[model samples]
Target chain A: MALDADATLGEAGEFGLISQLVAQLGEALTDDEHVLVGPGDDAAVLRVKHGHVVVSTDLMVEGRHFRRDWASAEDVGHRAAAQNLSDINAMGGTARHLTIGLAAPADLPVQWALDFARGFAQECASVGATVVGGDTTRADEIVIAVTVLGECTVSPVLRSGARPGDVLALTGRQGWAAGGLAVLGRGFRSPRVLVEAYRRPEPPYAAGKEAAEAGATSLIDVSDGLLAEAAHLAEASGVAIDVRRDAFDVPEPLVAVGAALGADPMQFILGGGDDHALLATFPDTASVPAGWQVVGEVRDGEGVTVDGSEYDGPTGWTHF
Target chain B: MALDADATLGEAGEFGLISQLVAQLGEALTDDEHVLVGPGDDAAVLRVKHGHVVVSTDLMVEGRHFRRDWASAEDVGHRAAAQNLSDINAMGGTARHLTIGLAAPADLPVQWALDFARGFAQECASVGATVVGGDTTRADEIVIAVTVLGECTVSPVLRSGARPGDVLALTGRQGWAAGGLAVLGRGFRSPRVLVEAYRRPEPPYAAGKEAAEAGATSLIDVSDGLLAEAAHLAEASGVAIDVRRDAFDVPEPLVAVGAALGADPMQFILGGGDDHALLATFPDTASVPAGWQVVGEVRDGEGVTVDGSEYDGPTGWTHF
Candidate 1:
């Protein structure tokens, strides 16, 4: 039934649909130490830590965030969870719980929802978070709204903490998703690795804790283009960041794919989006943790630049 | 600029739109003791209490949960906040923070967004909860998904905790919202009070705590019809709930409206949704707290009965 496209959400009914979701999620969760009460209740009761809980939410709409034709339902669920988890990671917190609200048409395949639930549960398990609670309702289009709560024992990193003389660093892939999107847009699907990267992003989940422990001044998740997000960090910290493009060697696949698609590899590295990389600022690159690459430096100014000047390329993504 | 109808979300751009919303919310918030980090960060960092935190999420979609014509943008925002808050309150927890995910058409007026922010901030303030974080995106229709985090020092109440001989009690108005919908559906604008109930429900926020303190065994928020929710409590608790309709003396205004429209007031009281009433079960009616009225009893059996018989009227509401 979970794989049947003919099984619609309406035919499944509300309670029945919820039962399937709860069953799938309940199986993935093992630790109840933090959970006092879980799903099938008015609200979930979570045993919170005393100091701080990092909370963030993201909305992924059907057409605006992802195209159904380009990605599977499972991929949609995975991307949604990955993007939000990266947000918690950027805050130097470990995600422990999540609640997702799903809005989809009544005629939507129940199989899609089941696959979505599977991906949601699987992602949470991968990060050691649990799907504590959620809500579902009928709508014209599908919308997945995920809110994640994290436990941070140490002082959480702030975007405003970066200062002059700080080194800017990055971890994980950059521009891979957008590069994949470009390939798909050009009717090229042979680059399976690039397309798979777009389908299932690999965020540097553990790098955040490592950076925080090693004394990160500030951090951000690279969901938007690298240049755009760097601008955000610059503005928040009241400092200028200078990026050296030479610091990054474009991955061979992306470079080859860019050449075939007539796209610029540098632009993919700088201005492409949805590769959930961790960007951080450290006072000294020598002490920087593993998996983190120092790419730039923060100075006493505003805005972001590449090689001491602003690069005239695509800066960010705006859904509208 | 916020009041200008011509100023649309797309015209404002994503960063600009976020700045406007953040400024408005920051201005509304006066305290930051509980907020480790607010908006503009990757995620909000809240000072979590040592005890359990109650969490809930709900999704409201245009044309399904609300009609833009029937509800003002502000009203939609308020109701959305209210419904989710009520769920937390129903669990006997105090709401502390909320994150909303909004999906709307690119052409939606910025003024409408401003109005929604105002209402959301105001409502959160009313309950001592702050708007911690949110997401915004473009879609064909407007969808507001809210997630609330709450703290409960005492053990959280569950719908499955009711025992035989427990008394059923209710707080806040019932069927008023449905009655208002009935009036509006008929295109009648004369009844101001009933219509206002539909636009913005005044949930009994304080009653939940009082009931919990007084020892409510089971509790639920009446988002669905009274009969429908009663059935839920019965099944979950594995007990029979016998509701006496005669015990609920229909308010004169509702009775008059029902009479005028040739509709049964009792039916409205039994089968209406979205009144946000707190329904709970206590060991005895004598212990029912203030602002609560005992209307029925939990007995040894299964299913819900109206005056010891299955209700033949509208049993529940299925939005689908």
Candidate 2:
């Protein structure tokens, strides 16, 4: 049968479709305190106490960002929400609210979208954030854009504040996500370590707060790789960093993936991206947290170097 | 010559590339005041006063949203920034800052990206907003996602709370953008008015603020056609709306496009989308400002009716 006229975006219409989708989402924000304004306005407003607000955004697209075959709708939603929240955490801020913009094909099952929403809510709950508002539209592919608002009690950590002779430390595992991706891409069905890494990336949320409280000079999330992010810190602070190869205590999953791929585990630790690990530079006398390992030191050089030399493999992910 | 590997995103790497791009933008936020923490941390923080914060986001995909042939990099940037800021204006807020996320192919011209940034900055300047923060990555296609943050001294206007017997009023012309799209699609170059509407939609920003000040019960932006938005008000308020066709003053551009496309001028007015006009419900005694025209009334019905009857033409934009 020919598609019904309403099936086309030109027919059922933008406003009507948006209203229908929005109606499906039950109100998460009460009309009381905390939320000054909610959905249905041009933008939702929340009450801020500390006078400063932390903000971050992420966009996940079909095919490029995630494959439907590899990840369920719920997994996509959870990952999308987690990534953005992790950014807030990295800044030593607590995520308070989020706004999502979703674009997907009409033929996709509505259940899929609902499932994604559920995952998003679950992830938000982990960090005490609520979905405040969102926009939904029809597109040829699925696209999820999430913006998160956060609150910080103390000052936020910046990349440009790392001084010469500072110590560099990292909290949380590295190369797990990249290793997991390699395993999945190669059609490895073992679901223990690699799958866990891919399904849920546990960022050191509490560690970031501690680092900030401990007086970190600079901080960044290891989303793009250890060395890659260190380079950023170096460039932003106008300092050079040297990573000690022996400093890495590679995780078991990364070692397993390296063995399977016939690759070096060190390469994954240094160059793999998307672990959501927190990398911070602190004064030389600052004590490292329990989970954090001192990996390098900042100097007045040029860029990130491994053992005072350039050790290059894959540097990290490139968008282009 | 073949493209150099280093020039590609895969070679430049995500972390290094982001660092390079961010360095070019330099520092926009102050070190202490507005920016408690700048980029390179997990997130960025900005300070705000004791006023409501307005936020809106939009996504523009290459091919689907805009063709490269029809719009330059600068035009796409301008349009993306305009649409998001307009949403804030519709809520009776002033645009303050914008965060952009861009995904483009690696081989794409760097100049194009720079031009896009310039365009975005220019548009933000027009609306009194700054390009605050954003993320950029490599993808197979170009995608521009923008989120704008606005501020308001008063409460924001919402799409709900319209009372029965309220007058429905609109600011700016309707259906001109739809007419412009028609002219462009048909390759008809004669009508400059229609073409301009499609290229840049002029939202009645000041008028929205005025409507809110004049005691509008509910307000919405006409991103999706007049009738469609009116339907939203009716559904949200549990009331029926009646449109007076005789009251509509069809703009000259829409009339010309209708003549050229052999379509009814009313079709463009009733169902055409993307005019970015402000639609609000006001009390009978409320004074309608200049550029705003009354075209309908809210009543104790269930749906919207044109001339006291159901409109059988296209309902609005569909997203399936």
Candidate 3:
């Protein structure tokens, strides 16, 4: 039976709303043979193909992470799932299952939650993952927290494995989301490419495993901007990284947006985040995998430098 | 290294506050042999001893699930951990790792987040679990979401396994938290037992495995009151559960609180929740393990009843 369009969470109730949302998962919920038990239970049971499991979690709070006016419930869900799944992918793991915890006000629409679940399921499906279980409760504002479970066939990559003389590589778009945000902030939505990129990030899920298989020295998810993530890898590995400004051919969309907004496109590539790009270090440039662009080089030091010196710009996002 | 007690999250910054909270995990982070990687990575890698894993997630919002005035930061953390751990336990699994997602306002005290981590670590330690990885961000209120990963040596007991003739049993105190909430709501804190129970539930973590070992046909965590959970078992198993009211002996604390408040102690036992007691169904009375009280029996019908009659009071909790 179709739920009334005007139905709110208070009217549908928790159990009612949950069932509706679970329906949104559809095939992804049961198609996974690894999932021994799905929802409507105390806990979900999954048969891990590999003995080793990679786990990560992320919280997306309304107003802080995304505003309801600017993004759809599906966009919110996709963003929430992408962040945690990217964490697992960064470890060279294939995501298997997701458990979500959602808190929303009573007046929230039930259809909105269902759409959120649909988006979450679709995002997981893109990487052959499933939504296993979750908990929902009432709160003053919407808070969506997702935890993803994954399996790594090979030794999981860590940020501390990088060493001096390593070649730095990146896969997936950089600064596209940042450019999209700037466009949205300026009250112009004509740049559909930027706005859509901001709405849903397309993280290169397969590149993580490919990098690991290609003998990556270290790997990290570039969610906190290229400069900040490079700094993180540097700090963890005790090696500095030097990004070659000439290496990057600024994408046409970003260039157009930057020109329109009177901003430097390089700043977006250097300081923008939310692209969920995979940043990895290889022992040599030849070891870097296909589909990855060489962006920088690792050196014996402790900080990130652009063109051998600091490029003055906001390095990354800080939640607080 | 001690942090300033008066420092807020905004003052300490995200990375600074995270390191402080991570320090609270202490030995749990490094001592786990199954954990290949802990925090400060893209994701935590765990070597699951068993091929199967049990996973669950829960969200606790400030003022909704708890109040800072009533619950210390530690208490909130403990409660959040307990809820997820109990889910794992309910599946007859041993918890191995936890990933937390926390969202708090910028002005929230750094000490509060640190204490929360301390409580989470302590609770995980009680079950030999470790805090693995998580994401922290800013929000208008405090939202703590926890996901626990566990392993079950034996097959997980499901709620749908109960037969009509199965014996219903319970382990752990029921309604204690409810009675405690009643006491606290009336502005009386003298009854330390009730108040403490309300602050943090003491679930019989071992009882679930014991029940599974003793040939439990079905199992559930009595988090939404005994009657409600019993009904859930019945509905899932397609049988009726008749709970014997006489099986319960009203404790002295509940009796005194009920008398003072002009309420019936039986109501708390029948309609209260949050104690996270384990409820299970055994094939026979002989199969019921020690430390478990035979509370009722399954019958050929649907729904739950007390003394073969419908309950007049509240059946259970509703979030919306």
Collision count for each candidate, in order = 0, 9, 0
Give Cα distance to truth, residue A172, candidate 1, Å. 0.6
On lDDT, the leading prediction is 3
Model 3 lDDT at residue B239: 96
What lDDT tens digits, residue by residue, belong to model 1 across residues B98-131? 9988899989998888788888888888898899
Shares of reference contacts reproduced by the candidates, in order, are: 0.88, 0.57, 0.92
Query: Model 1 misses residue B230 by how many Å?
Result: 0.8
Error of 3 at B170 (Å): 1.0
Residue A259's lDDT in candidate 3: 94
Residue range A1-320, candidate 2, lDDT tens digits: 22232353334444544554454343545532667776776777677777778888888778877888777778887888888988887787788888888877767665667668777877877777777777776666777888888888877787888999899998887888778777788988453676667666777777777888888998888877889889888988999999999998877767777787899988878987776889999897556666788999999978989988997788776554
Q: What is the lDDT of residue A198 in candidate 3?
A: 86
lDDT (Cα, tens digit) per residue for candidate 3, span A1-320: 56664799988888888877777875776678998999988999999887999988888888878888777989878888898889988999899899988899999998889888888888999899999999899988999999999999988999998999999999999999989888888888847887889889999999889988999989999888999999999999999999998888899999999899999998888998898999999999889878899999999978999989987888888988
- Better candidate number, 1 or 3, judged by lDDT: 3
List the DockQ of the predictions in order: 0.84, 0.51, 0.88
Model 3 ranges with Cα > 4 A deviation: none
Best first by lDDT, ranked: 3, 1, 2
Candidate 2 docks with a DockQ of 0.51
